[model samples]
Target: MSSRTQHSIIDLVSLEKEKINRLFSTADQLALNPFIPSKGFGKTGALLFFEASTRTRMSFETACAQIGVHPMLLDGKSGSSLEKGETLEDTVLNVAAMKPAFVVIRSGDDLDFNDITTKLQMPVINAGWGKKGHPTQALLDAYTIRKHLGKIEGQKVLIVGDARHSRVAASHVELAAKLNYEVAFCGPEGFLPERFDVKVFKNFSEGLAWATVAMALRVQLERHVTKYSLANYRKNFGFTVENLKGLSDKALIMHPGPINQGTEMDTEVLQKDSRCRVLDQVSNGVLIRQAILLEVLGGL
Candidate 1:
């Protein structure tokens, strides 16, 4: 039996490349299947959102059904007890009674996650944790990049947009670095964190002046509650129509989705760029997420 515990996905650094490759290979096979994945879920069910999302929910649901897990979901807003006053721990504990193979939850704060995972006996995957990490999205994003570029390691990837507020950006930085991709951090000085090891670029032109893939992180309005300024951030860190013109032609483009039009990118560039593989990214997510559920729970 595999000694690797169900809870091991908490840190991508600890995951062996062979295991990840197996998941990738499995996801690749699912693309040949005849139907769309479902809302019923398969072996691994999700808690879904503490925050709202579209692609993450759809792809996760699709992935679960494709793997044959019966998905049970609870959107806290539409729910009964939650609106009345049920704690996250209580909600998770109550849900575990039905014996889900796994639980994936997106929490509001990084530290808030400990309570949820601790309350559930089954394996749990963190969907996104505040400004800290979006592990699964990173996994699917990397899967898309590998599929699009036909490889992952040693590729040049430029991450552009609001680095400070994006958990996706933080997750990708760690993931890309682990995969041996040469990663660059691109954004305004105030929005980009100074702690990472990658090369940093204040100007969009400088970030595009390389043979590399470009990933634009979204600018969420919630960041204003923190140290970052939204208006200045939009003006400086935002990727403009002009910047995309200078990017490497062969380079693939990526985003986490619900991109801020005119903020992170121009509408025309998003619609027309050959390198922008955003749609493909979501498609790839369903496959990748299906593989994740399969790994944690025995599946079809």
Candidate 2:
């Protein structure tokens, strides 16, 4: 792919519905045949995570491996020039110098990737960018919803908890109109965003009853300055079996994990509820990421 056409997967809102549909179609193919022949043999990709991650990091690496692409991971925990105060842009430029076919970045701070992308010769994928957006997560989530509910349009998605600091929620809200799904926020006033055009539910029960999917979000304690009581949050907003009673029979439970057993949701709810599609979301993440890698790397 030419540098101009090798677009970065940074913002879902910038992508046309046709392009998003193409990604979903590609994910579907990978889901049907996970062992499909590698199309990216001998290519190398960079995984630069300035923030902590589990599913996004591992799944992208797995996707790269499946496509016969070598993944070089640079995490914040590990020693790097970043620890020596090297700027993220400089680090990315250094990686670009190595001629990696693509680079996936997850940063704690919201960054304007346009500047970096303009300087680079390779495709860039934003894994997560602070509370601004996580387009790949939104793509995988839309894929998961489609797989389970059989379609994306006309479904209601209730994003519960910590919307103020959730990139996942931000991305979902941005993509919701494009995908033709109704999305609303349900959380405490402090956790909710300062401004949103969509519906906001102060009462969790009302939101649950109205939604086709209930996606729980972790309270980012690490990101918060004000202390919060876990017990209070759980009693008011947690997805316990009793609280889940308000949920529609057909409604699916989701979490962009790691799930806080007693805080965001009950352990029983996550483990025993057949309606919970958390694992499916995790499983589908790999396929969606594979599709993304292939698309960005021009392997598909």
Superposed by TM-score, candidate 2 places the C-alpha of residue 124 at a distance from the truth, in angstroms, of 0.5
Against the true structure, whose lDDT is highest?
A: 2
Worst 10 residues of 1 by lDDT: 34-43
How does each model score on lDDT? 0.72, 0.87
Residue pairs with clashing backbones, model 2: none
User: Which TM-score value belongs to model 1?
Assistant: 0.88
Displacement of residue 113 (Cα, Å) in model 1 is 3.3
Clashing pairs in 1: 40-71, 41-69, 41-70, 41-71, 42-64, 42-68, 42-69, 42-70, 43-69
What TM-score fits each model? 0.88, 0.96
Q: Estimate, for each residue in 1-300, the C-alpha lDDT of model 1 and write its tens digit.
A: 232254436556656677778878878877787243433343447555777888888788776665567677876456557787777666777777777777777767734665556556677777778877887888888888788788888887788877777888777777775777777788766567766666888787777877478888886556654555656665665555666777888788888888888778777778887788888888888887777776776434
* Winning candidate number (TM-score): 2
Candidate 2 on 80-191: residue-level lDDT in tens? 9977888888898998899988889889664567667777888888999977899988888889999988998999999999999988998998899799999899988789
